[model samples]
Target: MFVRTVYATGDPAELGTAIRALNSEGRDLLEERPGYRGAGVFVDRNLGKLLTVSWWESEQARHNSDEVMRERRTALLAPFAGTLAVENYEVAVFHVLPRPTAHGGLHLIRLEFEPADADQLADAFHATVVPRLEALPGLARAALFLDRERGHGLAGTLFTDHHSLAASRAAQAAARQAGAAKVQMAVVGLEEFEVVHADAHAG
Candidate 1:
């Protein structure tokens, strides 16, 4: 599967209203598009940053839906406008345990690395990172998205609640450090978010 990410920073005061619009009107519009798989909406309220990820069955499907997506994006973000950026990625790994729930916590990490090391990175992720995360309490899902040509990647781990997320922080950091060193990937960005909405389907 492929995914398109829309990210922006907006007015913190309008965060709730923006999320509501995304969960309702935005989602409805996306569902009408062909090849729509699923989507996740995340927000860092304090920073007024929001990220929306929508999955598609193929790159073509994602491309075809771009215009409409931009239209939706404009309308939804108008109230809380800030800098906007978009990226496309291929889903490299997706692991789910008990499934995700609304208001769950998300640990998000962004990385930069050598494009040529993609295979080695994937191997290390599966052989090391996945196992370590699986052992964490309250963990629900883990996903990795890659833009091989740009040497960019994003990883996310979902926790069932705030307590679980707080409890696993130290362990998560250690695991992330070890996994990144194993593949020589530089950790560029790391942040926490609340899962505003999540709806996924099994293949």
Candidate 2:
């Protein structure tokens, strides 16, 4: 699968309204596009930031839906009246205990890293990171999106609630350090997000 994520930093006052608009209007529009598989959003009310990620079956499907997505973005973000940035990535590893829902107490960590051996890195993720996360408290899902050749990647992890998220931090950090060694990556950016909406298929 391929994923496209749009990120925005808006006024906190208007950000909530915009995010709710996405859960309704924006989500419906995304569902209509070709190859649309799953859609999610992260709202950081305190910081006034929102990130929306939509999944597609292929890179071509992702590209084809740009026009409609652009229109939807303009209308939904109009109230906030600011610019947003979009990024595309290829899904490498997607592991979950169960499907996720809109109410998921999502805490996401987006890590930007330099790439090395793509295959070896993928193996390291499954062998190391996946197992560790699978055993974490209240974790719902974990996914990785990458442009291996370009040496950039993003990872998202959803936890059940604040306590689960907080308790797992130290373990996640340690695991990340170990995984980083095997993945041969240079960390660039790492940020936390609150999941405002998440819809995952269970079949």
Q: If scored against the real structure, what TM-score would every candidate get?
A: 0.96, 0.91
Record all residue pairs in model 2 with backbone atoms less than 3 Å apart, i.e. clashing: none
Which ranges in model 1 have alpha carbons more than 4 Å from their true place? none
Evaluate residue 91 in candidate 2 and report its C-alpha lDDT on the 0 to 100 scale.
Answer: 85
Worst 10 residues of 2 by lDDT: 99-108
- lDDT of each model, Cα atoms only? 0.86, 0.77
Q: At residue 114, what lDDT does model 2 achieve?
A: 52
Lowest-sum lDDT 10-residue window in model 1: 194-203
List candidate 2 stretches off by more than 4 Å. Answer: 99-101, 113-116
1-203: candidate 2 lDDT, tens digit per residue = 88888888878889868877887888888888888988888877788888888889889999999877886786787676366888888888888776444555555555555565766766777788888888888888888788876767776778867677778889888778888877676556667667776765422
Q: Looking at candidate 1, what is the lDDT of residue 110?
A: 94
Query: What's model 2's lDDT at 16?
Result: 69
What CA RMSD would candidate 2 show?
A: 2.0
122-183, model 1: which lDDT tens digit per residue?
77887889999988888998888889999999988998887888898999898898797788
